[model samples]
Target: MLLTLLWTLQGWVYLAVVFDLYSRRVVGWHMDRKMETSLISRALMMAINLRKPPPGLMHHSDRGSQYASNQYQAMLKQHDLVCSMSRKGNCWDNSSTERFFSSLKREWLTGNLYSTRESAIADVRAYIAYYNARRLHTTLGDMTPIEFEKIA
Candidate 1:
């Protein structure tokens, strides 16, 4: 998942993407007010409600404060999900996340104007649905994320 580090830019939206470990499918995502515990929590909730991963599933992310918060960790524990965090300040540990954000910015953010956070939230919801269900991934043999999962 990503909390777009656009603090210097115009928007104040927090974006999160949930990628499957095996297929690299972005199974879930959301845009919200801030990079709070709730933001990541909602993203996890979407992934849980969608994929329904087995217990003790592992979720990896960068060592951002949003992911490191006690509330977030507690939620992960509740779901029996193991927490894996990247080392501080290192980008490669979460390179896939970086790539996802780059694609989102290049493919969507640059082409759209969301004057309000609510607008961005709504658009992100639709975009992520398309990303998971329709957008073909070259890495997944040109299959959409959900399709790749089905085949796998």
Candidate 2:
């Protein structure tokens, strides 16, 4: 998600997020002042550590430079994951991530002001926790992501 907290003391912060489609949960995320390969790599690694998904688990993302970087691609290969990229200039292919960002900005971040990077990070962390554990997801039979996981 391209963070719009440009008013922060440190400048704009970019968020790299990995969302699990099964339960509509944000499995991993990272925020940094710059949008770079390292930011995306860290987010991917965090997701791997949390889920340890099977070797053939399909990892889908947009064809962004960060996701296409050699460093990020190497990490995906090392983890034995399969890559699925949305077509260029096609936003519909990745609507789930888009919806997540929309909700994040509208439901959680609208009108919020962050004075520093840490403040933004703290709010994002809190929102992710709420989203995964308590927020009801209509797609998962109206259960929270954690609740759906328990049944699965």
Candidate 3:
């Protein structure tokens, strides 16, 4: 899924994230000035490299053009992932990722005004670290994502 951050001077920084639904963990993420297919492809590559998931794993996302692009679909096919897209105009199908982005903005980026894209990126990186290692989720039995994964 994708989210955008607006820094005071740098304007918008787009983030593409690949989230693990079961553990509510953000497995991969990339940020750039453009919201092109490459943005999401890089994030997907990071997840593929880190997890090395087996074939037949389901990959879900919105029906965005970037996700539907040939390059992105080719990557999914290469990884042997089964792609699932949400219904038209429906966001609930990818609600978990949507909620994660909501938390990121509401809890971490809401009050801050970053002067540079670098600063926004740094702050977002820090938030991801804290989110995975420290923030408790009620859905995960009040444990952090790392903790939930440890015993899962």
Candidate 4:
């Protein structure tokens, strides 16, 4: 999923994120001034490097051009991941990731004015840590994502 942030100086910053569906943890993410294939590709690379998921792991995404680019598709093929795209005009297929972005903006970014992109990036990075390590999820038996992963 992608998120947009506005700072006082810069017009907009874009964030690309990859979430672990099982644990609801943010496995990979990247922020940039421009939304491009490279942005999402870097995020995917981070997830691939960190998790090293087995072959045939499903890679689900929206019908964004970035996700559909040749480079991105090649990466998925190289990793042996099965690609899955949501139906056109359907957001529900990616609701879990959408919910995460909603929580991020509502819980952490609301009423905050960032002076620089760097500051916003730092704040988002912190929120990711808290989301995985501290925020409780009722779906996970009132445990944080990290705790849920540990137990599972």
TM-score to native of every candidate shown: 0.87, 0.94, 0.96, 0.96
Q: Which of 3 and 4 is ahead in TM-score?
A: 3
Q: After TM-score superposition, what is the CA distance of residue 94 in candidate 4 from its true location, in Å?
A: 0.8
- Runs in model 4 lying further than 4 Å from the true structure: 1-8
How do the residues 26-53 of candidate 4 rate in per-residue lDDT, one tens digit apiece? 9999998988998898988989998999
Task: Say which candidate scores most in lDDT.
Answer: 3
Clashing pairs in 3: none
**What lDDT score is found at residue 67 in candidate 4?**
88
Q: Which residue ranges in model 3 land beyond 4 Å of their true spot?
A: none
Best by TM-score: 3
lDDT of 1 by residue, 73-139 (tens): 9988998889998877778878877887787777866767667777777776776677778888888
Score residue 71 of candidate 3 by CA lDDT. 95
What is the lDDT of every predicted structure here?
Answer: 0.77, 0.83, 0.89, 0.88
- Give a tens-digit lDDT track for model 3, residues 25-92: 99999999888999999999988997899999999988889999999999999999999999998878
> How many clashes (backbone atoms < 3 Å, residues ≥3 apart in a chain or on different chains) does model 3 have?
0
Runs with alpha carbons beyond 4 Å of true place in candidate 1: 5-11
TM-score of 3: 0.96
